[model samples]
Target: MPQLTLYGYYKSSCTTRLRIALALKKIEYTTVFIDFFNKEHRGAAYAAINPNMSLPTLAADEGDGQGPVYITQSVAALEYLEEAFPDNGVHLLPNNAADRARVRSLVEVVVADLQPRQAAQTLEKLGNDFNANQDQKVKWAYDWCIKELQAYETLVTATGLAGKYSVGDTLTLADVCLVPGIQNAVERWGVDLDKDFPALAKIYENLKAVPEVQGAHWSQQPDAPKE
Candidate 1:
């Protein structure tokens, strides 16, 4: 078994994806909190660990006389976890090929389509180069998030694959990816999930009840602010 260390920030949705996957798989790991607000990710030390300077970098040590394996990108880490420890806990990917593709489609809607647009670095550049104000940046992220989520909702309904979770009855990587994005959309962007996306709203509600999902929520992270 490889010893794992996850480097992430509390509020980062991308980080939340890995957190959920880790919790679901019953994987034990150490968390090295990266303070995104203080520009810790941009420092030289973290940059060496992850050249992309992004949150949720997974470091794995097999203790088999080999160097540690570092995985950046949230989707990649989720896939790695699924493959490396397929029997650790519940299987995130489906048994069939088509169902696996469906799961990946939903995951991509949040990870690839929407998340990058709302990333802190992108928003910072929006303010620096494009002169976007704080409100404008929030709106910018909100619009993209809503659009992607609407597409996700449509896919779920159109394909008729959604059940209690994102794909059928099993909690796949799609649900892991969706929870954090939905959190940002509703909490930060004030998206009326009930009104705007009913299918997603219901699915989000069901996912909220999941123990692993709840544990991996931003509010549950160690670095989260006290209320």
Candidate 2:
């Protein structure tokens, strides 16, 4: 079996999602730290691996004699892991179609809606183009985090699908997306999940207690800065 390698930064929520999923699925892989602070991701070497110059690119040998195939997008990489290695570990998506759709819907609440706005590139663009200050950029991220988390809370409550986890009490892709999203919001953007979104807070608390999730924490990553 060819070794799996993940190229990412510890602080990236997207990267953290992949970490959580990989851990939950019991997939063992190596990591290459891409130092975002040094602008390593924008260099020619990384661009060769991922033309988009994004963090969290997953590469693995297909054992077909072809070079490793790389999955650039986090969500796409997750689905690839599920389909390609179904029997290896825990399933992140539900078996049923409706439940699957519900999980995907919740995933987009964080990936599509919230993540893009709070990404470093987005904040940098705001500063460069609009002359927005640090406080303003933080405000931009904070507002979106609150709005999206509130939407997530409302969706879970209204659908009644949430029991112990995001969908049907199982640790699905939705929870994988939620934990890191909330982490970025609370740690970077200063949104209090426990105070403003109690439902999500409770779920997050439970999810964090899981050994897989705890092991995948950003602080536990090899690239994370030491305190």
Candidate 3:
């Protein structure tokens, strides 16, 4: 394995997810910060790395004759890491196909369903298209996020997948997706996790104590905004 490089913004929830995955996998890597506020992701240099102009692009050295492999999108990067580093001892997906499907579904609840709607771009578009004020835009995003969080809580309980983690006893991609969304809800949108979503709050509390999760927290990132 050659050196790994991660390109992302510290404040992005998607980027935070990849950071947690890398930490859990114990992969040593370097970071190239893309300043989100300054539109650094749109620059020609980063555009060459990820044509989509997305955050959390990964470059992995394939060693030997193979050159560096570039992966974009947080979920895709995570799946790539799981497949490329299978023997590294950290598995993000379960071996059981059914369990894996369940985990993926939970992950989608956050990644596809929740995260996109709450993204800055989406919210900005919503505000412009609807002529909504800042408060209205925030309320709109918060409402949808709360709805999804409630759905996630129900899914965990109904499926009996609630254990020490999101889907089971061990950590999975679902937990990776869950933690950051919860963090954004609480810190960014002022959602009350403990009072409103106790199940997710419990899971969030437990996961926050984990060293990898704690280390990957947005506040701990080098490019996080200072007080």
Candidate 4:
């Protein structure tokens, strides 16, 4: 068994993705909540752990003489966990190289292209630096997120890669990335997934039905605000 510790905030989409991956992998982990609202992630202590001071920093014990390995960035952490615990948990990537590439391409559409543009940091910066109001911020987030989903919908339809989940029947890394992106689009930006993106709406519905995915939901996380 690997000793794993995950440091993250509840509402962060990146952190939520890691949570979904961990739950799906059936990996036992200790979670340390970093309160982003209070700027806890930017403090000196967290800075020492992750120079990037990003949410969802993962620390893992490899059982080698190298001691614990600390990883930052959501995608890198997920890939590391997949490689380290390949046999024990759900396979996140496909066996075929071409299929793996396709899966990664889908993952990138969310992780690299969509999520970053809608990140809290980016939105906050837009407000502070560009003097964007709340309505403007919402519009900016909604426009970019919807634009990306439009492209994603087209890609999935063109490639016929989606099944019960993205990129096939098995829940790959693409699903891990997709769910949280859609959640952010719906919850934060108030974009109607069902009305705007039917393909993604279907994928989101299927993903929500999975127990592990449900377990990893932002609303169910330890640090999520009580309603």
Candidate 5:
């Protein structure tokens, strides 16, 4: 077994997703925090680790000849983790060809459309595009997100998610992609899941109550939106 270390930011949705997966797998690792909000990711030290200057870099080190394997992207990191250590023999992708396609399709909708929309809202708050109004930007983003969420609701509800997890009553990369986006929609974007999306609301609720999520340490001091 190799010792793993993750370099990521606290508020980064991609980082949060990797943290949840790490906890679920029970893989022990040290987290080196980088502050994306303060633009620490743009610094030279991080640039050396990942030229793309992205968060959530994975490194595996063992005492032997095995050096370190560095991975920058979130989905890429997760796929590597699933392949390397598969507990319960339940894979992120399904064993069946059709099932794998379905899961990939569902994830594609969110990854392609949902999270990037939220990222624009996040940047507006950070004053990235000065002309973009934060309130208007967030509202627009959420509207797009909920439209996709509704479509996902139809997909999941029809796919037998109620039994246990996102695909086939078991946890998968689908759940990994899902949990973080829901967190963004609820915590960061201030979208009300109960009102906007019931099926996904249930999925969120279910994932939260899972033993792994309940035990997983989210932010040390979690805050709700101020009234």
Candidate 6:
């Protein structure tokens, strides 16, 4: 027993990101689920583990016989786990600071591009609508994705074919961020990669082939369907 645990929502893009990293690293963990639809994230117990009340909180082994080490935030959690137990697993930051900075820049754009849509959707779900403002926000999010994905297409083309993901032929934190952004766009926002952005189509297909990237959960499994 490695004494590691991960708290995540099966359908959350953020949760899906961390889950891929842990799986690729071959780290064993017990996954705890939080229902996003029912707002189970607001529960007291989960909030206690994550003050931000977010998904993908990883509890890694602290080398003690006691409980695992607690961590929150998918990005920070991934970085922390990598540094805490660095044994040649996938790395978010390259050894060179310049490379690391470049990687972080790409990662930031991916995250920044995704947040606007999420905010818009969350507000809509909560029934707050400024009419014109909401419409503009939605448009901005879609536009942002188009521009960012174009840039990503160029960047990946420049780098050539990576055997795994983002930066120098292995899965990195940037890759972790990339997968969820695509998932969000495709599932919630209904962006068609093949039709809207053919350049991104190849990358999306490649990512889908990766087992770690797939994880164990699917929102529309044969047994489960949206009501």
TM-score of each: 0.98, 0.97, 0.95, 0.96, 0.84, 0.78
Q: For model 5, how does the per-residue alpha-carbon lDDT over 65-84 read when each residue is reduced to its tens digit?
A: 76878888887887788777
Candidate 2: residue 156 Cα off by (Å): 0.4
Q: Which residue runs of candidate 1 sit more than 4 Å off their true CA positions?
A: none
lDDT of 5 at 137: 76
Query: What is candidate 4's CA lDDT for residue 56?
Result: 84
Clashing pairs in 6: none
Using TM-score as the yardstick, the better of models 1 and 4 is: 1
Clashing pairs in 5: none
The 0-to-1 C-alpha lDDT of every candidate, in the order given, reads 0.91, 0.92, 0.89, 0.89, 0.74, 0.69
lDDT of 2 by residue, 106-136 (tens): 9999999999999999999999999999999
Whole-structure CA lDDT of model 2? 0.92
User: How high is the lDDT of residue 167 in model 1?
Assistant: 91
Better of 2 and 3 by lDDT: 2
Candidate numbers, best lDDT first, in rank order: 2, 1, 3, 4, 5, 6
How far out, in Å, is residue 71 in model 5? 0.6
Clashes of each: 0, 0, 0, 0, 0, 0
Where is model 4 poorest over a 10-residue stretch in terms of lDDT?
A: 161-170
Error of 1 at 96 (Å): 0.5
**What is the alpha-carbon lDDT for the whole of candidate 5?**
0.74
Alpha-carbon deviation at 54 in model 3, angstroms: 1.3
Q: Which stretches of model 3 miss by more than 4 angstroms?
A: 64-66
